[model samples]
Target: MHGKIPMASYDEAVASKLRRVSTDSLRFGIIALIAFLTLVDLFAAQAILPSLVVKFSVSRATMGFAVNASTFGMAIAGVAVALLGRNIDRRNGIWFSLVVLAIPTALLSITDSIAMFALLRVLQGLCMSAAFTLTIAYLAEHFSPGQAAGALAAYVTGNVASNFFGRILSAAVADGFGISINFLTFAALNIAGALLVWLTLKKTDRMMRIDADHPPVGGAWKAHFKNRELRGSFAIGFLILFVFIGTFTYVNFQLAAAPLALSPMALGLVYFVFLPSMLTTPLAGRVARRFGPANGIVLTLGIAIAGLLALLTPNLPIVLAGMALIAIGTFLAQAIATGHVSRVAARDKAAASGIYLASYYSGGLVGSFVLGQVYDRLGWTTCVVVLVAALIAATIIARPLTAPRV
Candidate 1:
């Protein structure tokens, strides 16, 4: 009878904990909402580029400058946040960045000149990147290593959701109401997300304050880089997004040409294959906890490689099936790598995450700019070959993560 009583009490306790688990959802939703607001513009711009070119009487190449500008800004902001803004409170950093993001995003609606629009995009990128970097570092620092894996998975899931839905939503708005309305609507959402962050996510984790009190900016990098495993994490981080951005960037061009010419709406729907990553990414944390981060990464990258190979065939269903696999693998790899950074960096966790993200966004910048030309000159097959090689290199770089020390 007493054993039965204890078992009942234990079950009740578990139920109580499950109720509190809803808070994680709240926090995840707020962070995800903010990410969605900022990233929607990034993906949506691709769909709206033709409208932009027509509106400004500019060349397609010139219209691309805005995206490139934002990518550059994100890279610079990531570095700056890592090095210069080490002491900023995480909550306040996010709050400030959100408010700043709202201004530029709103300004984007009213800006007439292409140069001015590009400038606003750069500003928005700076603020958005800072917000994202800080939120990731905050999530990593607050949770236990195993739990951090889950938290980071949710975070990346939010990012994947943004990638899938943001583009679709933004493109729809632009199609229905014109480009200005799209920017204005996104700007309003940014402000609302900022308010939610400020009101609900009010307190910073105390551990973060303790961790931030470490070596100077350069020394912090030196400390993280000194760890061989962390360095591999950074490299893997760079390469994961490098291939992701590169593939998606050029696939649009490929789909728009030849026998498989697809409309803009169809292109956006093609990205829907990535929607599964919202499921696959969160599961990544569980995979890492069970299989170890190293093995999880290798498995996911292998899947990505296979997906890229599938693209070599000219069939649309086969190509899309390949893309879905690539998206799943990329998100899983990123979630594992991102969570591993938080686990492995013994100190200056923010710096570690910041540098990792800096590497990530830099990969995006380089892949889009450099590989766009690669596609233009060498064609889709060559681009796919380059991405496959890069994924293999990422798998090699991530091998150290399997070591006992890691």
Candidate 2:
């Protein structure tokens, strides 16, 4: 009887362990889906930039600025969230922002005026940034210490997957149906994302309470700026996105024009370049752990620089190789830097996320305008030069972008 009882207890314990493993897997899957939906819209539009340029009858620079105006809104919203995030409900804010994001996404289907298009993009950005900022804070609050690293790695992997699939989805939908259909499809995705978060995420009141003892959020920001490692991370984030926007945005025009006039379907297929990055990004934590964060970033930057230089070639296969290399390198670097920020910001992680995201997206905003103008005037060759230089500069900054020393 005693032996039977012990076996029963052992079996019951095994069942419990299995149940826990299943729950954690399910949780990580949900996190990855949420991350994918949250960021899909950010770069998807670039896939169809040529069509928009023709439809709007605008210059490439003007169209680039208008399409990328969302980044400016993200930059602004990041700062706002950084300053006021301590008072927010992470889960509720995330779902609500995603719900609002759908509205502007739907409106894009009908907008004909370039100005209105840009405005909608800005509004979309604001909602996306709000949701994004809150989602990061949500994960931090909800996950355990053991789960946090895996959860974050899943999120970053989702981010990279979104880059690949979002552009493909955008291009295929726009080509198969129409541009209007593309925006509407994305609008549906935004709502679906809202539903996912609303349904799966539980309300956790883990926000830092602002009593008399806590310093003001503004003071926190001031201190963040003063931290050398944080500053270096911010710089690397800015430069990475700057180079990314320059390469992907203008490269679309290059492919859509003259010698290599890839169809929308083909352009979408080309974003398969992001596949390698998606595979590599989830390993970022492992890489950083093995080689150290700064060394990892420097190594990745070297890959990106090599890729940037390869884009100077007029050959289609070589250009695609460059894109793949760039995608892999930048994504690995971004993932490592993101993890570093989350670790190093010991005091105000939410506030740090906001400022870091702001700097990151601001680079996209600036790069869109600056590199678009460069592409419009100086051509793809000169634009590649600028991108390579930015990557080189990022390598320099990445040396100090590691976690803060204890």
Candidate 3:
């Protein structure tokens, strides 16, 4: 009897072709550009935080609010975009959002009032939220599952690289000109990103179209809440980010003062912690593929907790070491968790992503405020304590992952 070729061979052949198609597509380039812009916005704000505090004579608590404002705006916009569903042309929506995002970023260059700056930051957050959600959704729609993970990881690498370079650039510019100029530089970057997307991204009819049969548009939110795995993942995301933001937000202050006494340039170099993410993100996908995403999440969270404890040692080398550990662990966790959500919620990918991201950013917002207060009231040690508590909570949530749904 003649033997037949295995099904796996056909799948591998199809996957290889799709990968080639995806890599050559203009959509991938646009997505990567958007990802780069996201990081620029994030670091530009962070790099200038210390300067802003000194200029306005604002307390850490107030600064926390300003920093968290971006996330708050993002969370709101995510919900709104998800609820709107596939009715809108995602490409146009993303482009429009970028234009909106650039406005507030540029406005930072002109405004001297703290109140105005804070308001602008919030608008930037909203625009960012929409842009990110739409871009990811577009990618998921266009690429096959096997190709999507690599593409997503590439997008994330753009984010990590941007954080690294954006911080360095902002710090250098601030040292030469001023913090305001740093904001302008990022604004220009965003404008350039928008132009790139406009020129490159192909307009397609792939947008999600909601109709009468899909009458349960509003029900998607409620439906996502019903997902136990998704809820657990969101909780962990919120807690982890809360601590992550809180720690990074006040770290410059800590370094600038006391034993470290690092200048802005020196402190900016600490952002090298982001570099490992470029590697860990792809590795995370492999780990998730082999051992399952839930297991990868738990493992990463444990590593993060250990990293947080390492920072408690009070040695400069130990602190940097700890930061590196946290960065690796957090990135791994995010990569796995994001991929898990996409895989699990195959039908409502965009809505699921929006919800998960909302949780992720909302955690940043709440963490900034709560930890800022902890820092003010009890000091850095207390801030660490809050992060430890959040880590413990993540561990508890992660425990359920052990017997995860197949």
Candidate 4:
């Protein structure tokens, strides 16, 4: 009787927390916008890569640097923010990151040299990592554990929004006016997002402070590495992104080739296949809470593998279906994995989140650069094989994370 009463009370407490987080529409919208603005510029670079290749008269391998540069910068920034950024207020950090991001995004328009373009991408990447890492850390810190997953899902949906429109809009604009205009348009949006963040979050900024009275802790690096669950989560983080980026980075080129050539705008539309991620990610928490995070992750990975296999088929509709499945699986798995990271670390959660983000973007860099080389040398078939292998590896690593709480 005693055990039953406490258990019921605990459940009620968690339910109340979840309801509160779900109802905070204004705060959720601002954070989601920050995530959207953070990633759009990077995806815009992906969309314009083909144009840059022609404009600079470079090989696909060389043109890939444009994409890799930002990812590499994001990886670096994740680590830096994890280690060095503990003292800054997250609300100010998020808006400031966007404000800084707009500078390089605006500069992307006029840069003629490939080297300079890549350099600007690197700068934008650094700013992007701050918003990406801090927003989720903020969510994790503010929401109750039971509610954190739902909040993270909302933020991640914003990420999916950027992924879908960033490339398509940029490609459409680049196809019509020029790549320069594409960059300029997104830059304007970035500035507007920054203003929105400041305006919306101004009143509540003090309430959301991550580490209020505690002195910033040290040894975060060693402590995070020592935690077994965290180690597994980081590995899962890396492999999932490695597979996701590897597939998408090269698909555009494949679609532009002889068999089923697509226009720039059409190529952008193809990314609509990824639109399902926006929906799947937000609902992922319900799935995780029902089944368990580890089980949910493995199930999503299996779905992703099936999608990759379907891509091996040459039929356009089949390929589109395959892309949709991959999107659903990838986002589902990522949402679970990311929310797990936020909940697992009790102290210096921001730094722990940073390590996970660092690994995640590091995987992206490898996927875009390393697998891109494989595509250049061997063929898309070999690239697909590599991505499948990586997903399987992630599933294996996630085996230890079966409990829903961890």
Q: Highest lDDT, which number?
A: 2
Give per-residue CA lDDT, model 4, range 88-189, as digits (tens): 677788889999999999998898888888888889899888777776666766778766755665677778999898888988999999888888898998
Rank the models by TM-score, top first. Answer: 2, 3, 4, 1
Native-structure RMSD, model 3:
4.7
Stretches of candidate 4 off by over 4 Å are 1-23, 140-150, 203-218, 404-406
Best by TM-score: 2
RMSD to native for every prediction?
Answer: 3.2, 2.0, 4.7, 6.1
- Give the lDDT of residue 19 in candidate 4: 86
Error of 1 at 294 (Å): 4.0
Clashes of 3: 1
On residues 159-223, what C-alpha lDDT tens digit does candidate 2 reach at each position? 88888999999999999999999999999999999999999999877784433365877887788
Error of 3 at 14 (Å): 17
lDDT of each: 0.77, 0.88, 0.76, 0.80
lDDT of 3 by residue, 1-406 (tens): 2334666778789999898787655555556667887647864556556777887788977886785678888888887787674766767877778877878988888887778877887898888888877777777777788767656766887777777788778878887788777778877888777776677666768776433454375576567678787788788778877877887787767777778877777777777777876677668867876777667777887888788888777588888888888888887887777767766663566667778888988998898888888877898887887898887788778666533356
Instruction: Write the residue-wise lDDT of candidate 1 on 283-305 in tens digits.
Output: 87688888788888999999999
- lDDT for model 1 comes to 0.77
Candidate 1 weakest ten by summed lDDT = 204-213
Off by over 4 Å in 2: 1-14, 208-212, 401-403
Query: Predicted candidate 2: what Cα RMSD to the true structure?
Result: 2.0
